[model samples]
Target: MDKALNKTQDRDLIKGFMKGNDRCFEVLLSKYKTKVFTTIYLIVKDRSIAEDLFQEVMIKVVRMIRSGKYNEEGKFLPWVVRIARNLAIDHFRKVQRNPIQHESEDYDIFNTIPRSEGSAEDKIISEENTRYIKELIQQLPDKQREVLIMRSYADLSFKEIASLTDVSINTALGRMRYALLNLKKLAQEKSVPQSYENKVQR
Candidate 1:
């Protein structure tokens, strides 16, 4: 069965990775790095923070694997995700205490999308819709919002999300499901049209 084969392959990859098979490790990185980074990005909503956290996650993963601390009994992706989530949480906590916001405001991912000149009505509609959705996302419970942004914007898989957020896959799924439900609720309350929903779902 595909499930059994996947398990076997994971085990082999872990073993190979532990043995300093750099290529095998690269394979693992290639498979999960973008998903992990995107998940982190969604949480922090800052490109620099996301990039730093992503690198930290990989470094921690490499260390754990090299130190033989990585257990193979469970899925690999989830474990790495947990690491990423923990790191992000720690980073945020540190920021809250020190309150030293990153200096590069212009580089924040959640701010300002590049756009070209368009008809006045089109621009107004687009900007209003964007503002509404952004507000809606900000209102979601932290967990649901985190999952939705990561999956919807950053394109992380549920498995990767679970790993990064330190939740079970089912929990990740639940958060995403509730996030969408709440998003729908917000859109309806704002009288967002079906056309907007269609675009968002894409």
Candidate 2:
């Protein structure tokens, strides 16, 4: 995607919306709904919960723009995804109290923090070919999983990941590197299909 063009379009849409052109808001939402919805679904993992959270995200986006709280110029998608991520995190804090629910008896990949739960039954990331891969992703260490998801699934840049994760840019890059390496090792150990393994960056 042409970043300059996207930014200009977003700016125009935002300005139009601010000037009471409601269709501009609709167009903006249409442009980004897939990304915003995917970000929420990847985090929440449950279709029903994801949908509910997605509505909350859209509502928040509208409110923020209307209230003049959205000041991130030329970064419309990342700004919106940040709101989605925060709302998903809030949901996790409320409902994800099962940090050790699925720990392997031999080894636990997750640290002490609460972990997000997902299953093969999910509507979005639960394809027959991708279910195991998603499960492996859930098994990744928390920080690495976060970087991988934000980079690969959320399509965030290293700088955005760093800012959102409260780390340095190099630290964000390092986490993504380690996340890929770990996924490779985990794929090999699990004998995951090469097709699915190839989906994650090598």
Candidate 3:
């Protein structure tokens, strides 16, 4: 039980994995997989898509470790998050439509974060609000939407996002600024205040 609650010593395990200790890789996954899943799910908001992206992220990490290309100097979580974020961005680009928009036959994540017990009218109103925000997000331009996701959901800093997206920090900031402006406009049109208002970078 302690192993479940305690933070995994990733450095030693990773170094061991580099030395061909395959069990260390398994240990690393057991320690971090839940956190990785949560992070990806929060961004993608679709269980199947998040699971697919999670596998892709893990495969890339494992391959990098095996290939001796893994850099140990950086924090593992951020590095993994960056990898996941980039893959998510690429997935978005190639698909050109939100995965949730399609009626999927697979499992649903919305059921997991269940609505609070409430009157039917309250539930209806909550769902409508959520759908409205999702529509607002969809209305954003590609770069703005990507930046907003990377910053808000992935929790990446401007510098990290710039590095990942091959843009200057100011450009990333600018994209974020424009994203807020667009989001606020959409919110106003929908007669709602933006939830991410304060988090938006100037």
Candidate 4:
């Protein structure tokens, strides 16, 4: 579907739900459930907690739309994603479990390499390089790592990331710049494949 049309449909659905058409809400939920759930799971790293948070996010979305509190204009997905991110963080704070481990065949972070021409890059990965790269990402300072994950893993635009992170767009861009630079340097030090380093540079 065209992006603009998707937003228009979301607006229509929101309006329909506001007018008490519950089915509109179902359509919206069915469209967004997986992405929203994945956002939660990325932070909490527990399926059960992610499922609970997903329900909370849906309830909040429905209530906010009904009460006219959803003031994000036409950007429904990013708005809901922000809610999911926050709730996931709040839950993680409560449980304080092991580090997050993202596992998604479709939304895999490896598919997000800079030179990645979509799925073409997925076939080039080596397990050793993958582990090294993941470790390098973890070594980044918190702010840098956060920006990189949101941009690369969540596929958020810099504008959306800045809005969600409450920073200027330049700041978001800068963090991503530094994150990639750091990763490239780390990769070089670890002597990862030149192909991987090339992807980072790109």
Candidate 5:
């Protein structure tokens, strides 16, 4: 019920913002700023750069909305997420930077995982497993990793992902399939427990 209410409220805010209500835009930013920044940070893995890109993303989103080019049929968060992802990817392409490395020491990857209801031992074990899986994800080919990250972290549908990547739906699906297969293969090679393997798929 709260989720539904929040969605409705977000839509109303967008409507108001489109009609030139500046306060509505502020509310919208307050609601999604953390989520948007986090999504970009996950992909880019740099705090300062992510912050700069986040501002650029918001500027672009506002421009699109004001220009009446933003697609209202889609949910706003996913739309913004797609924009941020595209901008980050474009930055990387322009700079020809090396792909994101899984720097476990540099950042606490475990913080990204949700804390499940369990004992301390179970939670620790889960975090360890999640970290291991994320490391494996980072090892995937760029396309596969991007698809998996969008699907898993951004909560985007395969169709949306296809559109974002400028690929056909089948290609997006294939990348996700390959990503899972590669993860599973890595898990086996690493001797990860079967239960953790199932969790990775989930």
Candidate 6:
């Protein structure tokens, strides 16, 4: 669907959900569950913890909406994303754990890559390249890595990312800029394929 249509649909769904329509909530969940889960997973890097957090985030969102605590003026996806990000950060703080750890069971980096219509072989090659790039992203400094993951995987605007990270817009932009530059340098150092370089540029 087009961006404008999607926004309209989301608004309608939110209205329905606010009116106690369980089906509308299900529709919203179907649309956003993957994005929400992936955002949490990218941060926590633990599938089990991420899954638990995802359920908690959803429950909180529903309760907030039902109690009229959620702002209807805000865009739904970004609002939910902000909640997910905050909760994931809170989890790390509570556990006194580093959130950037590289530990996951058979994680699929393909979800972070943009979809394209291509041959089976092309898709396979693209997935392999994205896996390598994901590792490169993981190697970045904490701030840079978090910014990159939020912008790239979660489809968050720099403004939203700045707010979430409690940094100025310029700082968020700087981190993303440095992330790309560092990733490109690493790709060159590792002699990754030209196709992968092209993907990074995109």
- Work out candidate 1's RMSD over C-alphas: 7.0
lDDT of each: 0.76, 0.75, 0.76, 0.74, 0.80, 0.80
Which digits, one per residue and each the tens of the lDDT, describe model 4 over residues 123-170?
A: 455644665666788778877877887776666789999988899999
Give the per-residue lDDT of model 3 (tens digit) for 124-159.
Answer: 666766666666876888778777766775567899
lDDT of 4 at 171: 99
**Rank order by TM-score, top first?**
6, 2, 5, 1, 3, 4
List the candidate 5 regions with Cα displacement exceeding 4 Å. 1-9, 19-38, 46-48, 66-69, 97-106, 109-117, 191-202
Clashing pairs in 5: none
Can you give the TM-score per candidate against the true fold?
A: 0.66, 0.73, 0.65, 0.62, 0.71, 0.78
Candidate 5 on 25-136: residue-level lDDT in tens?
Answer: 8877878887787678767766667778999999999999989988878898899998998899797896676655434466654555469999998887777776677567
Clashes of 3: 0
Enumerate residue pairs that collide in model 6: none
All models, RMSD in angstroms: 7.0, 8.9, 5.5, 6.1, 4.2, 4.2
Q: How close is candidate 5 to the true structure, as a TM-score?
A: 0.71
Q: Once model 5 is optimally superposed onto the true structure by TM-score, how far is the C-alpha of residue 1 displaced, in angstroms?
A: 15
lDDT of 6 at 81: 85
Shift of residue 45 alpha carbon in model 3, Å: 7.1
- Please report the candidate that would top TM-score against the real structure: 6
- Per-residue lDDT over 1-202 for candidate 1, one digit per residue giving the tens place of the 0 to 100 score: 2343234476687798788776677777777776787667667766777788898899999999999999888677767767877898899899988886653855645354555489887776777676677667877889899888667755568887787678999999999999988988887777674558778667
| Candidate 1 lDDT score at position 47 | 74
Task: Assess the local accuracy of residue 79 in candidate 3 as a C-alpha lDDT between 0 and 100.
Answer: 87
Give lDDT for model 6.
Answer: 0.80
User: If both were scored by lDDT, which would come out higher, candidate 1 or candidate 5?
Assistant: 5
Better of 3 and 5 by TM-score: 5
Candidate 2 residue-wise lDDT, 1-202, digit = tens: 4344345577787887877878778887777887777667667665567779989998998988988887855488888888888898888887767542432355422222133467534333335445676667777888888788788866799999999989999999998898878877887788675556567546
Of candidates 4 and 3, the better by lDDT: 3
